[model samples]
Target: MSEPSAGDPGALAARLAALPDEQLLAVLVVATAGRDTLAPLYEAATRLLSETGQSGTAPGVIPGTDMPPGYGPSADLGSSSQVDSGIGAVVGDPAATGGTVGGYTAGGVPTFGSLRDKVERRIGTAFGARQLDRQTPAGRGTEEQWEAREQAARERLAQIRTSLHEGEGS
Candidate 1:
């Protein structure tokens, strides 16, 4: 289905709902963290680096929206000003995305990075919870490395869940 314009609240809601579960989970992660929360984003981004390609646009000229200019009563869904567009731009490297969100390029396998670092970043974010981009180690490794990293992400997830639960109890 065509995405609704930013001005169309009803349609917008539908689009949000239609987004795939991964994207929805990412959105929920952001919402739970509060857009203003830096730690969570960095922690999430770190985990994402291990589990998924960085969010980004296509390498070539971005394919235009299916609709022609001025085609509908509602404004073009992709033409709205940045602020009007509720979501931030995707930020994946063309090579990593194979020019799209689908997956990595041919022969390009995904890998995981520092579990120690992931844990540190997640825990750091938990403690600092309000700050952004504190300490996330960067580099490369195979899926084996990801075992620890994924574990760290899971642990961080637990911490976040606990914090939320504690806040609710109050």
Candidate 2:
């Protein structure tokens, strides 16, 4: 694609508008797929439209950006075991270790619940609507779908690795 002429916002808009809805939607989908690779482009395009005062006439709404703040100093990040089991196993004393209740205990570190909380928080932050802090049940369902997709990716990667190793060994 050729670059737009300098300061030719109209030309740029025309180019984008010229794209078929399917192409535009494909661009949006591929860009927003998984980790949102096209997020910056999408953001820039939307901002361009808004700055040009043309957003009102844009085809659809531009999604909002609202990254949830991460956990504070006391936020717990779960351990490997805790993540697998969904339960923190006590390996030490709370008084001596200062670990949170239901957290993993390895080398006297108490950090299970906080980790889970952090993950949940991140899930909320990443998936939460800009307009709402607490996501609705349907939104939560979307998050679950994302989780399942992530798991599937991991499984596929593992399978690929195993196949490669077997091929090499054979």
Candidate 3:
């Protein structure tokens, strides 16, 4: 079957729920770590759901007046401004450390370098790919090699898919 669109919250939630414990934990860590970057993604997901009139419905269910779990209107939910400000407070302010209060430092700039070496590292031993180190000559060579190989593999895979389609048509 074709992949589900990212805008589908039900699909996304299903995918998240289907993940193995380790993978789910990894996703949670990544999500929590990149909460700042993911603000847009969250907004997009919510917007898409609202537009589809499925914001309050359960996954795979049609929209109606009754709100689903965690979907009910709250005092905070009354305004996008509140949500935006809350997200800004959580992400924009470097002092808003996880599970901690009153902890803003001068060196608290949340650069990718710091996040990679500090946040992600503390969350897990490794990540999907080496990003920062990939800038070095040697690292860049390795990354380029991997990318070239990956592109070749994708081309072959696409060709196979086309061939399969043609065979089915015949």
Candidate 4:
């Protein structure tokens, strides 16, 4: 019979079936390495291997040997039923994690803090705040004006904190 086209699934299956166990295993390894784009090849190799009763054993492994449970190819990794079915119940999910679908939290609202924030806050308190205070223009103003500005800043900070800690402790 003439060789079949590369895109022909039937021809591919027939060719794979004709391969010896070792060559078929090599094909399987190569197919597995390119799994994202070679799923069909991988499946064909796996099917051929299984048909020949050489499903899971890799090179150097003796066929029909007593292998430990779960170490064999027949072992179950996980079933779909074992997965969390709740909506937005996955890590980095926007709905569950309170972030945008693009994986970014809203501006000025910290989704989480790290050691960097603590270190920066400490440094700011120690020196940066004093430098900023000195550089800030001190215009003549009433006590009420100063209090209003301070209160506004405090409110803004509180709002940001509240946004960051929305679902905590519940």
Q: Which candidate is the best by lDDT?
A: 4
Would you list the C-alpha lDDT of every candidate in the order shown? 0.41, 0.46, 0.43, 0.48
User: What TM-score does candidate 1 get on C-alpha atoms?
Assistant: 0.21
Question: How would you encode candidate 4's per-residue C-alpha lDDT over 33-65 as one tens digit per residue?
Answer: 333576566546545655665533332334334
Alpha-carbon RMSD, each predicted model = 26.2, 24.0, 24.5, 20.2
TM-score of each: 0.21, 0.24, 0.25, 0.25
Model 2 agreement with the true structure over 1-170: per-residue lDDT tens digits? 98788689999678668886544543453343223455465545434433443321111223232212322223234456526533333211222223222243322243555456668878887765543633667767787899999999999999999999999986
Candidates ranked, most accurate by TM-score first: 3, 4, 2, 1
Q: Any runs in candidate 3 off by more than 4 Å, and if so which? A: 1-132
Return the clash pairs for model 4, or none: none
Between candidates 2 and 4, the one scoring higher on TM-score is: 4
99-130 per-residue lDDT for model 3 (tens digits): 11111112223333223335645555444345
**TM-score, structure 2 vs. true:** 0.24
Per-candidate clashes, comma-separated: 7, 3, 0, 0
